[model samples]
Target chain A: MYQALFFLFAASAVGFAINLLIQRHPIHSALSLIGVMGSLASLYLMLGAEFLAVVQVIVYAGAVMVLFVFVIMLLNADKEEPSDRSKMAKYLGLPLLFLLLAMITVVIYRQFPEDAMVQFGDFPGQTAAIGRLLFRDFLLPFEVISILILIAIIGAIVLAKKEP
Target chain B: MPPAVILFTLVKILLLLVVLLTAVAYAVLFERKVVARMQSRWGPTRVGPHGLLQPLADAVKLLTKEDITPSSAFRFIYTMAPLLSLVFALLAFAVIPFGPPLTLGGVDAFQVADPDIGLLFLFAVSSMGVYGITLAGWSSNSKYSLLGSLRSTAQMISYELAVGLSVIGVLLMTGSLSLRTIVDAQAGTYWGFLPRWHVFPQIVGFFCFYVGAIAETNRLPFDMPEAETELVAGYHTEYSSMKFAMFFMAEYANMVAVSCVATVLFFGGWHGPLFGPPSLQVVLPLFWFALKVFCFLFVYVWLRGTLPRFRYDQLMAFGWKFLMPVALGNVILTSFVIVAWPALSRFWS
Candidate 1:
């Protein structure tokens, strides 16, 4: 049952990703990205990282994507102008895709045995467990990443400011 | 999954929706009546007795009214926006526990589901509601709508940070995000009188959170999106008929949801004195919960009647320059107390 559910979400995630790339209008593309984020969040839920899943939805799909959509609206971006597909890309794109898929499959096959799989709902990574790991074990790394993000935010603010 | 469990969940969801929708409809009327008295005006006297059936009348009118779609508007998004708004607004209720659990269930009987991160789930759902307003304004292809959407997006985004941050102090006290657990933590009273609610110590947090909640719902004093003086009905300017009704429904539903959360967080949820028979025990907690939520709704209306709307710049400045800093300070204070509190008490002893 879990496997079936996982496959369904996985398929949808990839499908939405492709749709995101192919959508002409920026808003639709943003919506498709949100779909991809949502499906991936579901996949994370199935993988037993419930906190990660919710955070994924709240941060990426909810907040970040809203900003992207807001920008699209603000700019009033219209449909993309159609571009001619290059002859080299048209001939070789499919072959390259299949080649990449085959290489990824081979790498996966060699990395682990088929029986090594995620036990459904086994590792219920509840909030407390993740908190202990974050604050106690990996506190430094977490703080470092947070500081890095804060710096980036300050940088953006500084950059966005106009000259007096 | 068991079919029985699924069936029961569906039944629970249906029950919740019916009660919630009816409550939201009446909440609008409640606001109108309360605000009317405050403003010294007779509001909707003709529709039913004392505007009792006014919500029903409004529903029928909106449903029967013509839905006009602009020629240049993005038809798909314009139509879907209100649904998105209302759905996410309603989704938060799934995790809200109205009362204590019955013996029949492992979790609270009044709540639909109690995930570990129930509070965060509510924030997430509420945050997603911004999309509806954003899309509605953007897809309308009208200048007023675009402007309103811009202000809304900025206002909601800025206030949301304060809202999220303001609740950290409560979480620090309860040590759990689950609404049921948080309420349970506030089970007993302090000094045999005052309820051991988080609101007492976390007053600043509660204040910030309440303000942020008001902003999040786009209520008066913070309602830049559709302030009638500047923007013509804001994001819903191009929306008409039932679609228009849906947006209002979303706003009211959001108000109820925020009220419920405040009751759960600051007010001790469903934790009142029990009296009467065992059968009445089950109903009494629900009564207390509803009473608390109703008071919140009443206060919401009172504020609308009393306060003038903030200017757009003032709104942003209040949320960021003042509210955010205060919320952050509250968080820091709460955490410091939590860590050093026991030792400090020991030192005094």
Candidate 2:
């Protein structure tokens, strides 16, 4: 069951990523990105990272992608206008990307044998464990990231504000 | 898990779906009737007795109506939007325990799925509902739909912060993310009379939560996205027939989900007086849970009838400038009180 679920989610994630690249409209691409994020979230759940799965959906798919869609709509973005002289780049890019991905897959496959299997119930991702790690072990980085987010918010407001 | 357990869960899921669909259909009727009475007029009396079968009639009408798609619209996203909305709206209920666990054939059964991160799961699904409205509007290829959908997306995201912060108070008091644990924390009463509900102590949080919920559901006073007078049905301007009904059902479903969450978080969910035989004891808690949910739904309709919609700027200002700060303050105060509760209770005792 675990293996089947993992393969299904992984395949969907890759399909969505490819769809994101091929889609002509920005909104379609954005939608595909959301699909990729969702399938990845399912894969995370299969790996028993339940907290991370929820956070992945809540932050990336829910918040960031909503912002992306909002901007696309607000700006009234239309279907992509095909660029000129892209055949050489396209052909070269695909093969290079495929080779790189295959190399990475082979290296990881060799490093981690088939015995390193993911059993869903073996590692329950309880919130307490995540909380302990976040607050105690990574306290400084957590605080610093929060401060950085605050700075970003302030900067956005300033940038968007109209001159008096 | 055994086959019996699996079958039991399937049965439970079917039952919950039917119950929720029935509730959503009736909620529409309830809103129309209450809002009509508030305006000193009759509503839906032409259907069944006092509009008892109005939802059914409305369903048939919507199903029979032509499903029109605009020529200029993006076909795929427009088609998928309502389904996305309805699915996420209903998915939140999986974690909401309607009543205590029932022992049937030596197996525990109640909620569909009670994960450890139930509260976060609810939040995550609810937040993802933004896509439905936004995509529907954008794909309609209409300016009004675009404006309405954008407003809704912005409104939902802005209020979500307050919603999350307001719930922090309850989470702090309970120190757990599970809805079941939160409900159980408020099990007993105080002074032998008052229920030990979180509302007494977290009154400010409750206010913020309800207000945020109202905004989140895009109801009156915060429903700028679909303000009929201004946006002409908002993001769903181009949707028709069954497609339109999907959006309608999604709205009511979200209302019910938020009401259930409020009941679970503040008013002890299925934790009321339990007495009588074992069968009665099991069912009584469900009654209490339903009563609380009914009150929240009624309040939602009452607010719609009584209040006028807010201006777009006023709504944004309220959510950010006012509600967020207040919710943050409520969280801080709640944390302090929770830390000092023992000492304060000793003095009072």
Candidate 3:
């Protein structure tokens, strides 16, 4: 059952990612990206990281993708016609993308062996455990990241403040 | 995984769907009746006794109406949007605990599914629920649709933060995100007098949560997206017939979902007085839950009739500046109280 669910979501994730690239309308692409995020969230659930799965959907698919779709809608963006400026991305970017994918696959394979299986409820990366980890084990990194987010918020406020 | 578990889940899902659809239908009737009374007029008295059969009539009318597609509209997304909205709206209920856990033939059978992150799952689904309105507007290829969607996207995004943050106070007190655990935590009474509901201690959080929920659901005082005078029915301006009915149902369903969440989070969910035989005890929780939910639906309609629509700027300012800060402060206060709780008790003793 686990493997079946894993294969289903993983295939959908890849399919949606490809569709995101191929779709002409920006809104279609944005929706495809959301699809990818949702499928990836399911894969995260299969990994026993329930907290991560919900956060992935809530933060990325729910909030960020809404903004993406919102922008596409607000601008009334039309289908993309490739401009002369995108030559490098169309052809040259393929090899780089493949290399990145390969690198990630290699890292994952090395980290997880066949015996390192994903039995759904075996590992507990639940909210409380994750909380303890962030507040106790990785407190400095967490605080630093929060401070960075605070700085970003301040910067955004400054940028949004209209100049007289 | 097992066949029994799967069967029970399927049964639960079917039952919840029926209950949810019925709730949505009656909520509409309830709103119309109450709003009419507030305006010193009769509402839907012609259909059945006290408008009991009104929802049935509405369903028949909507289902039989012509589903017109605008000439220039984006057909696929336009058609898909309302279903998306409705599916996500109903999906949130799968995780919500309707009553205490009940087992039938050795299978846990009350909730559809109880993941460790059930509460967060609700948030995730609701956040995604914005897409229905957004896409419907964008796909309609109409200016009104675009404009209405623009407001909804902005409003939902802005209020989503406040809503999520407000609930953190409840999470802190309960120390868990599962709706079942949250309900369990609120069971019994404080000092044998006051109900041990989060509402008593986290009143500020409840305030922010309820207000944000109203905004998120686009109810009165925050329903800028659908202001008839300005936007001409907002995102659903181009929708007609069953398509329009879907959006309408989605709106009422979303309202029910939020109200259920409010009841579970703040009020003691199904924690009222219990008595009588075992069978009655089993069902009284459901009764209390339905009663509380009815009260919430009444309040929602009451506000709709009583309060005027907010100016768009006022809505944004209220959500971002006032509600967000207050919710953040409530979270801080809750965490502080929880952390210093032991010391405070020691001091008292």
Candidate 4:
């Protein structure tokens, strides 16, 4: 049952992505993008990462996608005609995409091992493990990342705010 | 035997589903009544004795209403958005432990689908609900809807950081991410009569989590997405009848989901006054759990009544500046306390 749900979610994700690519209207594309996010969240749940799954839905699918659609709507870009790309650019892009896809497939097939199965285990406790690593072992990096986020936030305020 | 167990599980799930749907229905009525009372009105006093059947009436009204699709909208997406919203909303409750495990037919069964990483699962699915709103707004080709979707997206993303960070403190003290384990860890008392609630030790974290949850749910004061005067019903402006009703259902469902998380994390979920027959232990904990959840839900309605809607910029600033920093500081302070004072840390254990 779980495996089937996983496959269904994955298939829908791919289907949504294709729909996103093929859709003429930007709004339609944005809507399809949401389907992709939803499927990804489902896949996360199936993988036993419930916290991650909910966060994916709340943060990425719920919040981020809303922003994307909101911006698309704000710009009123849906009525705009699809960009007419040069025939040469389309031809070149198709092969590059195909090559990337083929390379990914080859890498997966070649490096595939018998130990691909994911096993869930209790590693003491999640909170304890994260706390121990975050503070004791990875303290400096964690603090540094937070500082980086602080900087980014300050930068965003400065960039977005109008001059008095 | 396997098939029997599966069938039993299905039966339990169906029962829970019925309860949840019923709860969701009444939750709407409750909100209406409370909000009305707050506004100095009689509230829902019709339908079935003091508007008891208001939700059913509303449901009937919604179902019979015309479900219209915009001519220019994406056909598949337009149809799927509400369904996606409702599904994700319902799924988040899967791992929520309504009460302790009950033994029936000599087999112990708890709530449905308690994956090892249950906490993460709730977050993942709950977050996915935004798609439905955004898609509905964008696909409808309405500017107001688009704006509402945008506000919702930004608000959710911004508050999510605070929400995630705030929970880290509880997770730290409890030392577990599983909801069941977290609640069980808090069963005993700390320093006599002061219950082992994380709320006491992690007060700042609790506060941040509470505020962030309200924002995350798009409730009052933080409900910029659906500011009627500003956005004209926000993301679902173009939705009619049942489609619109799905959005409404998702909102309440999200509220319940977050409330459940809060109950488990901050308030000792399924842990309450314990003075009964030893056999009644199982049932009492669940009662306490429901009581705590009801209190949180009441707070949701209360805030909606009392608080004024926040300006968009002010809401963003409050989340990013005030809430996020405090949450981050609490985490750091918690880490410091745990590291610097071994004597103090022993009390937490």
Candidate 5:
């Protein structure tokens, strides 16, 4: 059941990511990203990261993607003009992406040579459990991240504000 | 857990969908009648007895009408918008506990899906509702639709902050994210007379929530996105027939869903005065829940009738400048009270 659910969500997530890349219109691309987020959220749920899954939907899919969609709409973003970047960028970008992916894969492989299977309900991600870990264990990082978000918000407001 | 359980759940889902759709239909009629009466006019009496059959007639008319799709519209997104709205509006009902969970024949059954993150789930789905209106407006390829949709997106997104913050007070008091648990927390009474509704202590939260919900559902005073006179029916200006009906039905469904959530969150959901036999006890709670929900729906209509709509700037200013701060303050005050309750109790004793 876990494998089936994983495959389902993973397939859709990949599909949506591809769709995001291929979509001509910015709105469609934004929607595809939202779909990817939603599928990722479901996968998170299946992995028993309930809080993370909800947060993924609320923060990423609900809030972040809405902002993306809003911007796309506000600008009335047209279809992508054919890539006008230099040949160096085109040649280097793909290989660089692949290199990055390979490095991540290698790192993950080295971290856990024998990949453990994800059994359902193996790790409970209850809100209370996550809250404890966040506040107690990852307290400094959490506070720093929150401060970073506050800074970003202030930056956005400042940037977007009228000249007056 | 078992085949019987699955069967029961399926049955329950079917039952709920039908009941909810019917309720949505009547809610429209109820709104129309109430609003008309407020304006000293009879509403839809020609359709059936006191317009009781008006929803049915309207449904038929909508179904029979031509579903117009403009040549300039984004066809795919245009088609998806109303469905998206309706689905999200209905989805929240799944987590809302209509009555107490019942245990019968060694089977536990109550709401559709009582996830631990039910409140978050509700918010997540509701937040996504913006997409429908946004898409509808953009896809319509009309200036009015574009303007309306933009206003809606901003309004809903802004007001949702207040809505989420206000709910924190109740959640802090209850210390649970589950709607069922929140209801259970507010089950009993203070002094054995007054029901322990969160509204008493979280009055500001309740006010914020009510106002936020009104705005969220895009009802009167906050219905800037669909301001008929200003935007030619707003984001749905280009839509016709069943597509238009879908948007209309979606609005009413959203109203009902928000009301249901409000009832569960603030009022003692399904927790009311009870008398008579065990059989009666089982049903009375559902009655009280429905009654509370009805009151909320009525208030929505009443507000629509009484209040004139706010300008776009006024609406945004109200949501951001006023509602947001008040909601934030309410949360802070509630949290402080909760934190200091022990010391305060010691002094009182």
Candidate 6:
């Protein structure tokens, strides 16, 4: 069941992304982007990252998407004419996408050992275990990442706001 | 390898999925009713016995409604966005420990999948929900939708830090990442009366989490994404019918997810007073869990009534400057206290 779900998610992600690239309208492309995020979140679940999955949906789908929609409306990007994909660009892009997909498939097929299937077990205290790891072992890096995020927040504000 | 075990687990998964989907349906009704009361009117009374059947009606309406795809829009992406949102929302509930594992027909039954990295899985899936809104807004090719998506993204990213940090205190006290273990760790009491709920030791963490959760859900005060006066329905402006309903469903599901996490971390999930009876031990824990979750849900509703919408800048500033720093400081203080007092660690153990 898990394996089937994983493959379904990956296939949906790749298919929707390809569709997104081929779509003429920006709106359609944006919607396809959502499909990509969803598939990724599902993949995370298959990898045993429950908290990451929730965070992915809440932060990425719920909040970030809202912002994307806001910007789409603010810019009135929907009314703009859909630009046709140039033949030259398509020639260059198609191979790149195929190469990326092939690489991903190879990596998955190679890295994941068949015998490495995760067995369900006692999961009590998993959050606490993560907490200990984050605070004790990964404390310095975690703090640094947070600071970097803070900087990003500031940068976003500066970029979004109108200059005085 | 037992056939019975496999059958039982499959049944359990199906059952839980039904319950969760049902809960998602009712949560929407609950929100509408509560919001109506706040606005000085009875909500959904005409549906079924004070609108009890309103969700079913709404679902039918949505399913039957016209599903329009914009001519210029990205058809594949636009269709996929809502499905992605709904899928991730459903996924987050898989690891949530609804009640203690119960024995059914000689088999031990628990919630859905219980992966070792359950909490992280929830976080990752929840974060992925952003893509749905972003895609919806962008694919709609509408300015209003884009602006809404942008606000939602910024808000979620900013508050997620505080939300993650707030749970550190509970993690420190419990020393387990598993939802079941966290509840088990808090099963008893300290000083005979004070239950070992993390809320006492991690009050600051709780406050930060509470605020961040509200932002994460795009509830009042942090609902810049759907600021009707300004953004005009935000990211889902261009979405109609079932596609729009999917986003609605995701919001309520996310709310429940956060509430469950808060219950486990700070409210001593499924842990209540033991009356020294064996039967009570089995039933009371589930009751406690339900009570805690209900209280959090009530608080969610209450906040909607009590607080006004926050200015976008103020919301961003508060999340980054106030909540983040406080959460960080609390973590430091907790670590210091744990290290300084060996007795405290011993007491928890």
Segments in model 4 whose C-alpha atoms lie over 4 Å from true places: A1-17, A27-70, A79-164, B103-110, B278-280, B343-349
- State candidate 1's DockQ: 0.79
Cα lDDT of model 5 by residue, B1-349, tens digit: 6788778778888889999999999999998888889999998898878879999999999999998999999999999999999999999888999888886544445588889989999999999888899999999989999999999998998999999999999999989898889999998899988889999999999999999999999999899999998888999999999999999989999999999999999999999999999999999999999999999999999998889999889998998899999999998999899999999999999
**Model 2 Cα lDDT, one tens digit per residue, A1-164:** 67788889999999999999999989889989999999999988877788889999999999999999999988888889878857888779879989999999999899999788656765656688989988999999999999999999999999999999
> In terms of docking quality, how is candidate 5 classified?
high
Output the number of the TM-score-best candidate: 1
Model 1: native contacts recovered, as a fraction: 0.69
Q: How high is each candidate's interface RMSD, in Å?
A: 0.8, 0.5, 0.7, 3.6, 0.8, 5.4
Q: Kindly report which residue pairs in candidate 5 clash with one another.
A: none
Please report the candidate that would top DockQ against the real structure: 2
Query: What is residue B163's positional error in candidate 5, in angstroms?
Result: 0.3
Range of the 10 consecutive residues with the lowest summed lDDT in candidate 5 chain B: B101-110
**Looking at candidate 2, what is the lDDT of residue B45?**
96
Give DockQ: model 4.
0.49
Order of models, best DockQ first: 2, 3, 5, 1, 4, 6
What would the per-residue lDDT of candidate 4 be over residues B1-349, giving only the tens digit for each residue?
5777778878877887888889999999989888998889999888999989889888999999888887877677777788888988998888888777776653345578666567766766656666777677767767788788778878887888898889888877766668788888888899788999889899999999999989988899899889999888998888888888888888898888888889988888888887879888767877888889899999999998988899999999999999999999999999888777887777678
Model 6, B95-198: lDDT tens digits are 88877878786555656756655665666666666667766766776778778877887888788888888888877777666777777787778898999888
lDDT tens digits by residue: candidate 1, B1-349: 6676677677778888999999999999999988888988988788888879999999999999998999999999999999999999999999999988863433335889888889989988987899999999999999999899899999999999999999999999989988899999988889999999889989999999999999999998788999989998899999999999999999999999999999999999999999999999879999999999999999899889999999988999999999999999999999999999999999999
**Candidate 6 CA-lDDT value:** 0.79
lDDT of 2 by residue, B1-349 (tens): 6888888878888889999999999999999999999999998898878879999999999999999999999898889999999999999899999888777755456788778789999999989999999999999999999999999999999999999999999999899998989999998998999999998889999999999999999998789999999999999999999999999999999999999999999999988888899989878999999999999999999999888899999999999999999999999888887889899999999
- Give each prediction's root-mean-square deviation over alpha carbons: 1.5, 2.0, 1.9, 4.1, 1.7, 6.0
- CA lDDT of each prediction against the hidden true structure: 0.92, 0.92, 0.91, 0.81, 0.91, 0.79
Steric clash pairs (candidate 2): none
DockQ of each: 0.79, 0.88, 0.87, 0.49, 0.81, 0.33
